[model samples]
Target: MTDTSKNETNATGAPVTDEAPNTASADVEALQARVAQLEKEVAEYKDQWLRAVADYKNVKRRTDQERADLIRGASAGLILKLLPVVDDLERAMNSVTPEVYASQWYSGFKLIPQKLQTVLDSEGVTPIAAVGADFDPNFHEAVIYEAAGEGQGGKVVAELQKGYMQRERVLRPAMVKVGQE
Candidate 1:
């Protein structure tokens, strides 16, 4: 006897229907869409992580720079306080008479200033060239405006006090006598 049902039998006598294949294809399509959505979310999360890492590196670099700047400022302050002592030593050495200059004590005393100057030089402290240069308020403080001499108009004729620089920054401005027309 022949079966009258729409279902057909496979080799193992199991009933097969066209609707079964369509249902399985629909499930596969849903699963593929879910996978695509997950991939997009993962990409977004990865981009956020990279940006966070870059921000952390920038903050570290800025903090390190600030620390170095603070150290330089503190050292500059200490050097400012020592400049007067250097001037005093220079004055004392200059006033010594020939007789006193020839003494053993005078020679030893002169070495003190030389040693102090060496230390300052090693720390990047340098004297500003004020004499014979054009008068500028940034590096020279005009203590007296003197009458111009030959070819000395608007120039620094003499430095009453020495000026110093720490690296590129001005530690002190020179006290100068400026010549005017």
Candidate 2:
């Protein structure tokens, strides 16, 4: 005769008891907790990745701006070297006799300074007007101080060498003669 008080045997042949239900519920609660934790971690990782992408974009923009600024100022040195040649050409043109000035060769020679000036203009180089303007130490370098004539006190009487500005910045100061009171 079979004993009725014996525990029930499952398909696996293991004796099942009331403790099986409690253990299965505990496992389900633990799995839910683990899923929540994994979700939280994934959110944090996503936020960090987004921040990294933003930082990279900012750095790239800054680098591009710096490169453009560098390119704009790169021609400054060469232009500085060419300034003396321009000065010489202007002096020669100014000293020309009336007979020589009327010659055909003088007309062709005059084009050289015009071309150089065009190049300077395209590069944003502009000559500073010093003569007759009030002398400022920033844009004018005083080479001589002479007695003021009429209303010329504290003004630039003459510019020995022309000053130039590249863009908004002074590339070279004018060598000038100032009028003194």
Candidate 3:
């Protein structure tokens, strides 16, 4: 005397209901939605991490450049200060006549300037080409403009003071006399 109206049963007496398929389908849909949400979150996190890594690389590159610039700048200042001494030495050496330069003491004077040049070279210092080159304000400061002939016009005819650079950056512009055509 089982009540047939209360529940419907299959062959082994398990209750069968019309809502079962709907319930299982709803659960599957919910699980699929959760999976999609998690995937989106993962994608977002990955994007953020990649951006952070890229930012770090940029910062590192900037830091290295700054460090190199600082080192170069420090040397530039020191070299600028020493330029006058080098100029004086050159002047002294040039003033000596060829006969006087042949003296034993002259060798010592020559060595001093050569050693200074070697130090300057090792520090990446270079002289700006002023005499005979086209006068450029970036590398030469015009001290005077003089009348010139033919090819000498608009070019540096004389360097009043030698200009120097450190690693391509101008430490001082060369004082020059420019030719006026």
Top-lDDT candidate index: 2
Q: Compared with the true structure, what per-residue lDDT tens digits does model 3 show for residues 1-181? A: 9867448887889677776789989999999999999999999999999999999999999999999889888888899899999999989988999888789989876898999999999998899988999989999999899999988999999999999988878989999999998
Question: What is candidate 1's lDDT per residue for 28-118, written digit by digit as tens?
Answer: 9999999999999999999999999999999999999999999888888889999999999988888999999999999888889999999
The numbered model that scores best in TM-score is 3
For each candidate, what TM-score against the reference? 0.83, 0.79, 0.85
- Candidate 3 C-alpha error for residue 122, in Å: 1.5
Give the C-alpha lDDT of model 3: 0.92
Candidate 3, residue 153: Cα displacement in angstroms equals 2.4
Per-residue error for 3 in candidate 2, Å, reads 12
Residue pairs whose backbone atoms clash in candidate 1? none
